[model samples]
Each structure stands twice: as structure tokens, then as C-alpha cells.
Target: MAICIPPLDASTESSAERKLHEALRSGLSDDFLVLHSVKWIAKPRGAGPRDGEVDFLICHPKHGLLVVEVKGGGVILDYAMRRFASIDRHGDEHEITNPFEQAMRGKFAILEKLKESPFWQKLGLGRIPLGHAAFFPDVDGVGGLVGPDAPLDIIGGRQDIALISQWVDRAFTYWAGPGGQGALSELGAGGVATVQRILARVSTTRPLVSARLVQEEQTRIELTERQAAILDLLSRQRRVMVAGGAGTGKTLIAREKAARAAEEGLKTLLVCYNRGLADHLREQCEGIEGLDVATFHQLCKRWIDKAKSELGRDLMAEARRDYPGGTEFDHHQPIALAFAIDAFGPNYDAIIVDEAQDFGDEFWLPIEMMLSDHADGLLYVFLDENQNIYGRSAAIPIKGEPMLLDKNCRNTTTIHAAAYRYYRGVRIEAPEITGTKIELLTAPDIDRQARAISALVTRLVAVEGVAPHDIGVLLCDGRARSSFERALAAMTIPKSSRWGHLEGYGQGSITVDSVAKFKGLERAIIILWGLDASDPVVDRETLYVGMSRAKSMLYLCGTVAACGRVLDAGVA
Candidate 1:
């Protein structure tokens, strides 16, 4: 048996360790770099512990600072004193992995690999002053990496944890160089370049994702600088959260993220608010291989169904029975149930949530429950608090920071800027496609609105080259069906009706759809007809979501006043 194990609370200590790292980053005269949460699976053939991820690797210039394993986790492990260390590894397999030892071996391997890399000297982030430590920040007064009777420091007035940390800092100071000055600039030039090359190779050969946008008629649809930056940020972070206004491409980013996960050999789930978006996502992700996208409720229902099927009960009956009706519920209840049961049912390696602000408190509880303690799954969230009409989500749920996606990609920057003018507080993210313009039309009634919309759709597809499938129309409630169909019939545009179905729209089914049901998909030319300026909810925002759907052109068909409202809303 080992006399003492490494610190077991590395992750918990991450907060404090992070503070120290940030301090080092700010105070260090030279780079004593800490590589965060780098997974180091045992190479195909190697010595030492074969599989695990490294929390941090301290890179000094000359002498190697150790690769440290941080454990935010507290509580000591005394295996010799106790026999209750049995760990369930699933499927009847039982094993015990001491976190300390695990961390130690990981440190050794990372240091060894860094020492042997080709770019160790050229790119500048060299591996000379390298060392490793397992920090437990929560144990403020704690010292050493052991437990209660095992002789570990506990947080208290008597504990000398700060002194111990200072000692560790001094102990590992040699990693920053002979005198610990950490001037390995020459070394970094080479090491940084080499690490980049190596990572590039690994990514090319065995990537964490394989991604591409599925666009047949969106040649003009270009990703803005902000969109590209968001993608870049997504590439670096293990957990990414995107918060943007409506028509800000949150769902699109979520889809793109799914594609990236698939490219990286990870299974991904694209979760949305309702079946409309869910079904739309399902259809869109059809050609993207290895992507397992679905609605959260749908996926949860599937899980509950699978679990319940084994117990011999009708899953649908049970799920719907809770509502005493069908489909819609208190909204929070289904979400709560999904979050609860599937908390441990991640079922996949990566997850992306869209319309996140619509989710409730207990929603994430299920996700947390489903995650394995040491699992390397990536969690990404996409949401916009401004779009949260229901007051459901909180900023930074699960402690994730929001990455602002202010560039609007769905509309011409001009039209997107318009919504911001109406709701001036909103920040509009610009699109890469610059020439597209917003057109507003004044109509006496539905007849004129339909005529204007039909004319706009025809011009966009025929004159501008936008695909028929990429053009869509959003009609406000009442007489919209007859108005849209009559206009389209006059033009001989073939259409289908989703009139009664729960998710009532399709790719090429028809030109006109309800604003609520057309949540997940997008088109190049979007016409919103019959927008009622009088309705409280159908104001700037209601149309904002509708207008942002068009990639090239937007046509608003409404009363003269409503038309003016739309036109004024477009000019931010």
C-alpha cells in the first residue's frame, strides 16, 4: 500500500489554484505556464499510468517546474484505515482509483512528453523549469496531500496551509530557471511552435470534431468576424456558453457546434425548447453523420421510456399522464423531469443546449447527475437572456461565462441594426454579407400584404438567385392561411399544410407559417405578413426573430402603420 496518496481535491482546489496561476501569470517575470486540463490518454504503447487527463503542467524555462495535478476536492483518503474504497465502474465492474496516484502519474507523463517534443525550444514555450503540484484551494489552511489521520492540514486558524503553499511555490521556483527568473523566451519560440504543430497533427489525424454547415442555397450567407471568433473560442474552451439576441444565430451556432463535435469523434446532442425546433433540428442534422441531435424533452422522454420499458409500463401514457392532457405542460415540469432522470444519462460525450434561457433551475440537475465524476465530456450552452420572455434561465448556469455573439448573421447588417433602434438597448451583431437590404411595404389589408409578400418572394428567388427552399414567410395569426395560400396559388407555388400537426412547418411544405412554430430553421428571403402592431408580444422582437430569418432580403407586409413600425424597427 502507498504510504500517502497525492492530494485528492485537485479540482476543488482549482479555484484557488486558478487564482495562484493568474497571480503567477501576472507576477512572473518570465513564463511559468500551466497547461489546463489537458487529457493525456496512455499512448498506444508506453510506460507508467496509461490513461488520464492532466490538470496543469507548469512550464518553466530552464529547470522543469513540475506538472501539477490540482484537486479542488477535499477530504482525505485513508485506505489502510478503511475498506470502503470500492468504486463502481459500471456493468458490474468494480475498481478503486486513488485520485492522488492518478494525478501523480499524469504529471510524470506530461513532463516526459514535453521534454521529448520537437518544438521544445523554437516556439518559446519550452519545457525546462518544469514541475508539478496538486493544489486544493478550498483547504486554505491545509498543507501536504494527505487526509485526517493520514496527517493532512485542515482549514483552521491552527493550519499552516498558506505557509505550505508558499513553500511549494518556493520549492518549485527552480522550474522558472536556474534562479527561477523564467526567461526562456528562446525556448518558448521553439516550444510554442512545436506544441502547436503537434496539436495540429493530432487534430488533423484524430480530431475531437468533424464539422461543416449544411447549406445548399446559402452562398451569400457569410459568417461575420464575430461568428468566426466565437468558433475560434469554442475550439479553445472545454465548456462554451453563447448568449445572443434573437436572430443572432444561437441555434445556428449550436448546430455548427454539433458538427464540430462529430468531427472530433464525439457524439453530440442539440437540445432546443420545443418539438418545432427539435423536429427542425432532426431534419437539418440528417446528413451530418455521427450527430445525435434532439429536443431535450424528446431525449428525456426517450430515456424515461427506455428505463420504464424495462419496468413494464407504457412510457407515453406515463409522461402524458402527468399533464392529464398532451404535449404542453407547466413548461418547467417536463424540463425538471428530463433534467432529473437524465442527469446521469448524458448518453453521449458532448452536449449543446439552445434556447438555454428557457430552461428552469432543476433542469441542469439531471445533466449533472448523468455526468461521470472524471468524465471528459464537453458542455456547451447557447442562450439569450433578452429572449427569455418566460423568466426561466439565469446567467452563467453551471458556472459558465457567456461569450457574446453580437454579430447578426441572419439579416443585412442594416435590417439587424433596425431591431436595435426599436429596442435600443439590444446589441446587434453584424453579418459578413453586407449588400442585403430591408424592404418594408404599406398595405391596406391582408390582400395587399399577400400580394407584396408573394411579389417579394418571387423577385428574391428569380432575380437574386436565392433558392426557393431558402425563402420562407411568417404570417401573423388570423386569415394568414387564406391570405398566404391565395397569393401563392396565384403564383402557382406548390405548398403543403402543417395546419394541425404539433410541429406545423417543413422545409418546402409552404411559404407561410406561424411565428411560434418556425423556431429552428432559416431561409434566405423571409416575409412576415400580418404583424399586428397592437399585440404586446408581437412588437419589435416578435418581428425581429422573423426578419432575422432572411439571409438576403426581408419583406414586411402589414398595415401602413405596422409597415412604418417595421421599417423604423429595422434601422438601428
Candidate 2:
């Protein structure tokens, strides 16, 4: 684990030292312990200038201890006089502090500190070996230092950096002897352990996080730096509304804020309009305590279930009798809301609603009433009015101006440009493209569309190298799910694939979800099917939702008329 002692003095570090620090950090393994820009106290308190700074003190189990002093400017070495001088960019030479001498002083100070430290003093290190070197990152050459008097072995430029491990090995052999036949042979393994304990006195600047953990974190949907900053700002407010275009990471920010609230011991509820999105959030927040994830209807159901015992009436039974089995809950939401409010009031510390644009003004009232009375009670809503395919045009029920997130980090520039042109009236910041242009495919009928989509998926897997889970096939019309399934069956794709009607696939399975279901989620590549511009207004929003789901690549498949609506701004 890397460590820092007494923090860093930025003013004291030359440009060369900074560059060398970054180089060593990137080159070295995590197993090595490093302390950089450190102040080593030479003596007991007030005994002259005690603070002696060193550029870096690196420690490893096999390499023992290494101290490095960095110099940035050009250097002139006099072999006869054994003097070192610094040369500036203007070719003027100036006498500078000898790096070797500085390293030695810092080394002495470090040893003294180790001996004085109670933790290290107990180790009882006896004559532990240490290596010191001078690094010149800016200097390309050293002149006048030749023959036996030259300290070529101790001084190094950039070219010599690759041989540092060999140098450390030589130092270990010289001071401790080769193999088990070293100077500390009598002390054995115990003495080496003590020396390591001495060098480990420096404090770590940050906790050790594994590379795998970092990689996993990177794989998860991430917010841009600006979006993260806005999230931070929202945390400080009592109520907030965030509005962003597709791929702007609004849902990611909502989940993050909900997770943070749970971490802070708040009773948090994360709600979204899409059932698939709610399930996704629930899975993402699996182990988080005091955090509940559910769709708006699911949340209302829970409240209704609670009211059954208190009101001494089966509210769900009444709803079922009225709305019947296959009825959508959007029309019954107000009834559920009334029942929920009468049953429970203000039980949660924070309420975060995602896909808020899909909710009517009244849908938020019961949710707002669920917040606790504390001043810090939070009600954060994230939305994108442009993607409001559900036709909820009422004003949102919340206070304060919504913070706008214009950056689209999810899609490549090409796909985002197409989506922007489709919705030209809305404000959308152009995204930085790092992938291929969107592929618009035409098929005369559903049969040909299916074949084309299957081929695209095949090429994406074989040629583009995208993983199965990273790919998605979106169908807007529910009726097209079976046709695509039959076409995919004809292609004999793996049985591991999942349709939206089935249970959760979790990960590692290609998903086929409707555009409405796939909202608030994204994939590396997308194959959009079943968009027909016969109803241009409906098809535009649906097609927009499908195309925006692709982060890197988008393969659009439909009749020529449907694909044309996507290219032209035909939907209002």
C-alpha cells in the first residue's frame, strides 16, 4: 500500500520530482509501499532545522528500502572536483545542492525517526540495508563526469529507470550478501521482518483499493464529472429536481443519491415509473440497508397493503374489482394515492423519484407527503420532459427550478446527433463520440427485419466483440415481441436470452425489452426494431427512446418509412 508522511509540500517539489513520482507510481506494483514529497525530521524537537525533505522512499518485501532524490534541471558533473551544478533552459549553469548529499541527510533522518517511533523501536532492526539514488527526469545527459571518480552507478536519467529493479537487487546483495548468506544471516527472517516494520512507519494517503474493484466500478453506469458535481449540490438541498436529456445519466445520479442517503442512515425510498428500471435499481442496491426500491405502483401497493389492517378494509380487492386483471395502474394511481396517504404519513427520511417526467402532477403529492418533518428531509426528482412518452403534460409537483444536465455521456456522437435532430426543439449538448456511426438498416417487411437484426447481432458479437449482456434488442410494440422471438429462434441464438415478459435475467444475457420498459437503462449496443412511422407522432418518441439506449453503437431496423421519421424531425 502506498503511504504519505506529514502530507506533501507542493512548493518544495520541482517539476522533475512531480514527473518522477507519477512515473514510479504507474510503473510500480501495488505491493510496493511508497512515500513521496515527505518531510523527514532529522533530530529531536527544536534541535536546529529538523525537517529534511525527500522526493520518494519506496519499500518492497524483496527490494528492501530505496530512497530517491529528484532533480529537474540540467546537471554538470566535474570528475576531478566531484562537484555537481544545475543548468537552466537558457544554458546558464548554477551551483545547486548535491542530490546525493540531500538523499543521505533524508535517509539519516528517516532512520532516526524509525528508531524514535515506538512502533518501529520494538522491531529491534540491526544494520538493515538501505539504497539511495538521484533521478534526473529533465536532464538528457551528464557531462564532465568520467572515469572512476564519476558517480554513474548512483545517478540516473530516464533511460536508467527500467533497470531500477536490478539496481535494487545489487544493493540488497552488497549490503545483505547473496541468497541466505547475507550480513544479517544470524538474525534470519526475523531481522528482515523488523526492517520492513521500520520502513512501514509512514502513513498511507488513501486506503488500498484493488484493481478489480476499480474495474468493476468502471463497468457500472457512471456520471460525468459535471453530473456528479450537480448530485453533490442536490445533496445539500431539501428538495431538488434534475432534468436532463437521454443518456445524460439522470437515473444514475438518482440511484447514487439514494445509495448515499442509505449510507447516511436515512430511511430512503427510490421510485421510478418503469418496472424494469425499478427492478434494475433494486438489484443495484441489493445489500444497502434502509433503502427500498420499487416502481410507483409497487410502492402504492405496499401502502395499500399496510392500510388493509388499519382501515379494516381490503383496498386492493376493491381496486381489483374495479380495474380488473389486465388494467394499467396509471388510471388507478389517484385511488391508491388517497388510500396510501390515509393509511401512512411522513415515514421516510428521503424520497428519490426517477423518470419523473412520466408522472402526473398529482402522482408526486402522496410521495411528497411521505417525507419526514426534519429539515434535511430530501425529495429529489430526476426527469427528461422530452422523453415523456406517457403523455403526462401537467406541471411537476415540486418547488425550485430544475437543474439542467445537458451533457450526454452514454452515446457516441453520431447516435446522439441523430437523436438530437429528431428532438431539435429541446436543448442537448453534443456528446463526444468515441464509437462508429449509427447504422440505419431497411427491411421490406417484419420477416426481413428479423433476419437483418439477427445478422447485426451476429456481426456485433463476432466482429465488434461486444458481450452478450452489453447488447439489447428493443421493440416498441408489445405484439412484435413474439415475432422477434420466432425470428431469433430461427437463427438458433442461445436459450440464455431474456424477453421483457420473463423474470429478471440479471447479467450475461441478451435482453429484448420494449422502449417503455428499457427507459432509464442503457447498453453498449442496441438493435432497435418495430418502429413504424404510420403514426409519426407515436413512432418518433418510441424510436427516440430505442435509439438513445445505445451507448457505443446503434443498429436501427425497420421499414423505410419508419427509419425516415428518425432521420427527420417529424414528431412534435
Candidate 3:
């Protein structure tokens, strides 16, 4: 049977009350009493003129029950007044609710219901006391809801509310669980009702992190005139394609742009086609804050799933405005895009597709679709056609449309110069470091190269002070298993995986495989052990990708003749 709870805050309510209600929805306290109170005393949403519903309910097992409510003026903010939330229709204007009195009325309604409810007597619910509270402030342009009795004035702000939450949690500990459930149920019931009534009037503003968190330190890397010009316009363009060769700083430039965006009060998203490049970014962006970095594929999965849950779309459709595009965002709008996202679910605020060169062809469509829908969202991208180790023929996602960051920051000047001479048509600017002599090494047979590589790595890590983790070997035919076997037999290396993928963190490595697999990845030293010169360009590309992986060193021990020919023009 339905229980009747009076509409307690009936006196004065409007749309201004939404923020408070929404904030309390999903996280209705973990305490058993708190949870019960919230669920049982929930105010009938949309039953009146208020624009929103209560945040959440907290039914206690004992003590006066708490009806949790949130409140703020039109806005909530950081110390310098960077608005996190506003209480009104726009960022301006305060709501019109007296939170305190409204809370009392809510308490009364719950009491009324408790007295009449057969469920109350059957369950012994009426003995519970009642209490109510309103909380969470509004920031500029952000909002919150309030009961008619809410405190319209701003207090200590967001920090105060955080403290208040602690107090509330502690005070209600008596009703947290099994031992406390029964007593709390009777005592806190009324308090929960009042809070619900007021809470029902609140709404959730945007999260604070997205709006406020920022970094203070900044640094600079000199840019060429062309680089400066392209980057300048790139700062403003949302969707851009950046393509170039070895020293282009395509990666470096992208990082700077993302950092700059964060500084401009916009979120920064950095992505790469390869795990290696992504790792390199993590290493490079170590100190800079506010950059949300990830691989293109990973982000696509996240946004689509998040959006789907929010919209509740169990079925698929074409271009559902709501569905977020996931993993395969190959450019151009496609019917397939809708189906894909319909399954995964939501879109993100912005997107940055890195390493566009290596992503399989025909993947830009969904990306275009998602980036088109969001506000102030980015569609930033970076890549180098010459660096397409995957051999996919997908047209670069952006034409004149992309912003290029193709400056090589990882290589020395000699390496950069050599890359340019050896690899023509590649659009990378050489690093300014003086050249390091390129050498070729080969054994009487395959055995010789392997031993040299293994020894080189051991020496670098043990004597050179590089972490064993910082050295990697690139071998043909997926020789990681072979290496593991030898290492296990010889007891030279331990059998282990990087980052605990077995525990479900990531797909990590224990050995050598295709250079493509390690694209975007880096180690302090790279040892390219096996080589076949059958396809010079292909081998050159693989060598390029591998060489670029090291921040400090590259140890290549392959067919001397083949190596020399590949490096004949120059060394990358």
C-alpha cells in the first residue's frame, strides 16, 4: 500500500531547487540507516511546482533521522571566485527557498506519514526521531537547489560543505549498520523526511575538477617560425591534423597545446595511436597538470559506455544525438557509428586523436560524429605519414585541417639530421643535438646478434644505471617468448609482466614482437636485434619507430650490410 507523505515545502519552490536534488541521487550515503531513510522517505518527485527532485535520503536506524539537503546562492566557487556552480537559471541570480523552514516542514511530512503508515507499526518505524539538513553550495554558472527554508547566503563555501559531510557522517554513525539499524530507523525517520523534502528541490551542478583544477608551473621549448605560426592558429582550432617527420615535435607541440588549453580554463585531452607514444607522453607530461591523457582507443570505449548508461538506450539507432562515440571513430558519419555507440553509450566533452597515422583506415567517421556534438570540445589530432609502421592506408583524418606538432624532442641533432637525409618526404624538423656515429653490427649468424643485444641491455641497466625496465629488445617473429625461455633457463631475467595485466590493468609485455605493437612506447635504450633487408622502406620505417622509442640510446645488432644500406643516407 502507498503511504501518504505531505508536501512539506509547498510554500515556495521553483526551478532554482534542482541542483541540490540531483547531487544526492546516486550517492545516498553508505550507512544502512542513512540508505534506508533516504529510500523510504524519498519525496514524490515531480509531484509539485519545484523544478527538480531531492538529492538523496538518509534513513537512520536510530537517533533523529536526517533529511539531507544541499544549498547555495546562485553560485559556488574557488577562493579567487572561479565559479564551480551557480544556483540560478544562468550563472547569475539566487534561488528563492528558505532551507531551514523548508527542512522543518519536510520533517513534519515524514512524521505525518509515520503516524499513519501500517508499515511503520508493523516494522516499528514510528519511534524513529526526525532531523533535516541542506548542504553543498552553488558556484558561478553552476547551480544548486534549496528548500523554502534554505540558507540563501553563501558560507565558508565548498570546503565548509566537505567538513559538514564529515560531521553528518559521524553524527549518524549510530545508525550505520546491523547493530544500529533498528534504533536509527525509528529515531532518524523524521529527519530524513525533512531533508528529502528540501533535497528534492536541489540539482547537480557540473563537477569541480572539470571546472577548477589547474597547474601553476609552465615551461617553454623554442619553436621555429613555421612551427610558431601553425601552433598559433592551432591553439584556437578544435579539430586539427598535425603530420610531420622525426624532429617535428608533433608530440611535443601537441602536449604544449593541451597544456595551454588547460591554462585557458579548458580541459586538455592527449592521446596517441600507440601505447609507446602514450607512455612517452606520460613521461614528458610528468609535471604538467590538467591534461587528461589516454590512447585513442581507450577513450572511445569510456565515453560511449558512460553516455549509454546516462541515456538508457538499450537499442541502437543511427546518429542518436545522445550516444557517445567509442573506440572506432574513423572519420565521416556512418550508420555503423550509431550502432557502435548504441552499444557502448556516451560521448565526451572533447576528443584528441593522437597517432592518426597508425590507426587502421576508415576509423575517422565516429570521431567526427562525436566531436561535432559537444561544446567547446576538441578534435585535436597528431601523426606522421612517414611513421605509419602499421601499413594501414587510411587517409590522414585531417588535411589542411590538422595542427602539426612535428618537432623531434627525443633525438640528438645528429640523429635528427641523419633521419632527414636518410628518409626523404618525411616532415620532421631535426633536433639540434650533434650527430652520434651510426654503427652496424652482425654476428657470424643470428646467435651473435641476440647475445650482443642481451649483453648490451644487461650492461646498460647494471653498469650504466638504466633501469632494466628502461631497456627493450625488438626481435623478429615475436621472440619475446623465446627471450623469456632463455632468460628463464639462464636465470638472467625474471618471468614477469609489465603493469600487472594478469590482474587486469593493461596488455603489457615480457618480450619482443612487431615494432608496431610497441609504437608510442619507449624505454631508455632500444635494441633492434634481428633484421632482414628484403624491404628497405618497410625496414626503415620499423627502425625509425624503434629508434624514436629511446630517450637516450638505441643498440642495433643486425646484418651489418643491411644496416649500412638503411642508414646510408643518414641515421635516425
Candidate 4:
């Protein structure tokens, strides 16, 4: 088979080594699979190389496995000590680990890895033939070769790549065992298939560096000219309402303005409707002095606590009366806002609110109470009415006319087209950008939906090469969280929840959250799981928020009936 080299960055590799690698890639027959920079996690121990990085692992159907260690520069072999060194251009000798020993440890690590993977054991591939080789591309292989015991047959220069290939074939010609089973010659068709399967499983490849993803993240956070102009005007104008549809950079603008306010030595309080969105904003604005980030309820709770002593009224009792048997602090937001308007207020130089659509009329009175006395002190509001999932469509009580941010800087054109259907009344702009089309997956039940989600996650990670954090699996409501969790567990795909503080969640782990919880947050790839079309109005609003959360890729997963309703709602 044609040689297949895994993704690698040639910048860190030596010129000679790169040249040799290219030659091998071109020269090897279709039977060989050459993988570079393969990684395997091994338990930490005092022994050799602790099973981390392997330079190269070559697998062939007929030849079995070969672990090759490539070295650059003039390789010097010590005849007496039997050690290895490389001489630099200035004639400096740098002692190096023996390539043969390094390759042998890597071989052992691979064996250990295979032992741990139950998938490999099920394949029935027994004893796998293993070989080791040290490649020195700068060393002369054609003439003046090292004497016997020098491993000249395996240790060769660029000229002997074909010779090395021949040596590999010869090495495995007489080798016995399938892996842990009988001899290679005694293996049947099934056993041979098992060998192929095992080889494929052990081969893992990722680029040494992903410059494209880095650049994409940078560009995403950077503001466009129009957005900058609006931000500039809003920053200077002080008190104004900013209106925009999903992906219009409303959240980002709010954040920038808040950051600027804090930088100007003004005490700022940045608030949002959703607790999750508040937490996200807090994380983004971390380390900015003179800034306090909190949810609307959180802000209300602070004032409510103070109002107890000043108002001479039991605010908790009043809140319970307003929302009977409610345990959450949000249930008291209206009562607290009313209390603040009547009895308590703390002046903040700047108060910025995001996800303003989720707030009710009572919220604005308290916001007004906290406004600073100075003219430059700002109170900015950002809203996208279509995203108001709670059906609270109250107008933001701001003095000046709302500045409209029409251009969307987040989602790609394809994604925007799919999301814009639900936002019909808004002037959603679509730039000439290309991206994956919105995908709608229909399943019979939760089980099938889980399977579909699992498969999609694998494809996005392995095929499209998207990072796990960039991918989010969002549920329509918290009740569906268990079903998605069950699906993920059934598929054996480990994922982190976005519900709590998530202290120990690794950045590379896939995130699971409700669509409502993920409002004001953006991911590169989003899978909206367990959409309920029973209430078309509610479902439409929820899906509108979830669909726009994906910056580039969007996957809608639900039952056939639910999907039909979504399609009827004009969102695909």
C-alpha cells in the first residue's frame, strides 16, 4: 500500500531528515503505513523514556511493525563503548541516547498500549512481529561504511532508503507470531484481518502544531471596522441601547465596552440575564480592575441583602410570595429590583447588560437606580429579541434610540443562512464566507439520537480535525441533560458538563450544556441535542438561540417529529 505519513510540522525537523522522510514517503510501496510523531500515554515510572513520544511507527500487512528512530547530522559510533554521538559542523560532539534502545522502549510502550486497549484484544491479533531501526540520513551508506556489529544494514543514509525497505521486508520474512498467538505463516484469513485492524488502531496522528486553528481564534475575537466604530461611539456616548440579532457581536461589544470602562478607572458592573452567560463574561473579563461581573439575580441579591436592614421589610418573604416554593435566586429578581428602586441603590460608574432580551420590565428600574451621576458614566444594553426564550419581550427603557449592529461577524455564511430563517424581522447580513451547511439529523428516539450524536462527534474530531472544546452538545432544556449524558456514556465518549464551575474540566474535553445555559457563548461546532417540538413557539425560540451558537458548524439532533416541526419553522 502507498505509505501514509501522519500530520507533522516540518519546521522543527532537520533539512536532511525531512528530505529522507520525503524520499521514504515517495519510495515505499503501497503496503507500508508510515506514521510520524505518534503519541501514547504510559504510566509514569523510573524506567526508560516513560512511553511518551515515538518518532515513527511503520506498519505493513506482510512485514508487521517497525519502529524507526531518525537522527540528523554526522552520526559517530563509538567502537569501544558501543555508544552513539552526532558531530556538529563546528566539530562539537553531543552524546545522544542509543536509537536502537529508544526504539525498543517505544516498541514495548506500543505493546503495553495494545494490551490496555480491549478493542485490540477482541480483534484476535496475537503475537505481533516487531523490529527496530536507526536511520542517519547524513551518514554515508554507499561507501566507507562502519564495520561489522555497526548495524549498517539498518543504519543507512538517504541513498539506501530502498535498501532499508528491503531490509524491513527481509527482517519480517522469517519472523513468527501474529502478536500473541501462533506464527505469522500459520495465521488464517481472520487472523490476518485482525493484524490489519490492530495496526490501524495503534496508529494515532495529529499535527505537531495547528496554526490555522490559532489564527481562526484570533480572528474571531478581533472586531471588524464597523464593529469597532460602533464600539467607539458606544464607549464615548455613555447611555445607549445596542440592538442586534444573533452573531452580531453584541456580547463581544458589551465586553469590550466594559473592559474599556474599567481601564479608564471607572467602577463597572457587568450584568447578564443568564447565570451561565454571566459566568462566561466573568471569565472573559478576568483580571480587569474596577469591574464586577455578575448575573442580574446576583446583582439583585446583593441589593436585597442590604435592603433587609434599610427597608424594614422581609424581602425574602416578599420574594417567596412573588414566587411560591421557588428555591433559586432568580425567582426574587423582580422583588429585589422593586426593593432596590424603592429603598436601595449603589452607584456604579458603568453598568453593562448583555442578553438584555431575557430580562423583564422590573429589571430596568433597578438598573436605572444604580446609574452613575457623571455624564461619562455609561449604561449600555445589548439585545436580540428573537433569542428571548422566556417570552419576556419587554422593551429596554433606554433614553436614546438603539444603535443597530446589522453585520454579523461570528457565524459563516452557510450557518447564517440557516439561522436567519428564525430571525425574519431582523436585517441579518451574510458576507461571502463559506462553511459547512447546517445539518439536521432525525432519530426515532433518544437512543438513536445519542448514536447519531456520538458518530457526529467522532467525525468532527477525527475527520474534520475540530478540537473537543470547539464542539458543544447543547440540550434544549435541563431535563434532557440526563438523556444526552446517557447517550454519551453509552457511546463511551468522555465529555465534561458546563453546569457547575467545572473546575477540573480539561480544555480538550467535549462540553455538554443546555441551550439556555449556553446563551451568549459561541462554539466553533455545536450539536443541539434533544430538541422538543411539542411547543413550536418555545422550540423555535430555543432552537434559534442554539443554532446561532455555532460559529462555523451546526448539527441539529432530535426525533423525526421534532425535526419536522423545526423544518416547518423555516430552520434547517
TM-score of 1: 0.56
Of 1 and 4, the candidate ahead on TM-score is: 1
Q: Which portions of model 2 show Cα errors greater than 4 Å?
A: 1-222, 309-311, 316-328, 331-333, 374-376, 424-426, 462-465, 494-502, 506-508, 534-538, 568-572
Model 4, 1-572: lDDT tens per residue? 34555443545456655755665677678666677665533322232112245677767665666677777777666656877788777888899877667777887876665554444455666666676666767766523435353344445566676565665554454343335325543333443344344333222111111112232354434566567667646633557888888877787778777876665446788998776667666766789878899988887777777777776677777877877865544446666566665664456767899889888765776776776543444688888888888778565767766888888777888777766777745576775568877788888887888788877777767777776767777787667577668667777443432222122224565668777777777777888877754445646677777778888788878877776676566643
Candidate 2 least-lDDT 10 residues: 203-212
Expressed as tens digits, the lDDT of each residue in 369-393 for candidate 1 is 4433214556788886655544565
Candidate 1: where is the Cα deviation over 4 Å?
A: 1-198, 201-215, 218-240, 246-249, 262-267, 274-290, 314-328, 331-346, 360-363, 373-377, 389-396, 422-426, 460-466, 478-510, 533-538, 569-572
Q: TM-score each candidate.
A: 0.56, 0.59, 0.49, 0.56
Instruction: Give the local distance difference test score of model 3.
Output: 0.48
Better of 1 and 3 by TM-score: 1
Q: Each candidate: what lDDT? A: 0.53, 0.66, 0.48, 0.66
Best by TM-score: 2
Candidate 2 lDDT over 1-572, as tens digits, reads 23333233575446776666655655566655567765432234333223455788876655566678877778875645767788888999888777777777777777665555444545565665676767787765543333352256556676655555554444345445455435541333443344344432211111111111222234443456678667647645667888888878787778777876665446789998887777767877788888999988888777877777677667656656676642446545546655567566677877899998898765766776777643546788898877888888656766777888888877888888776655634477877766787777798887777777767766666676655667778887766678777766666444444333313544446777677877877777788877763355656676677788887788777888777765665554
lDDT per residue (tens digit) for residues 1-572 in model 3: 11212222443253223333322332234333332122122112222111122333445434455655455444433324322443555547554445444455656665553443333434444355455555544433212332233323322234433344444554355234436545444444444454333322122111100001112112234666566656656644556777676545565567666654443333456766665456556555566545677666665555545546765543223344434553324432233444555455434434566677776654665555554234345667777776776676765555474544556665666555544554546366566665455445566456556565555545654566554444556553344536433542342432232311111222223235456666655444556655543245545676666566554555556677756655563434
- Give the Å error, residue 93, model 3: 46
- Judged by lDDT against the true structure, how good is candidate 4? 0.66
Report RMSD (Å) for each prediction in the order shown: 13.4, 14.8, 17.3, 20.7
Q: What is the lDDT of residue 379 in candidate 4?
A: 81
Q: After superposition, how far is residue 208 of candidate 2 from its true place, in Å?
A: 26
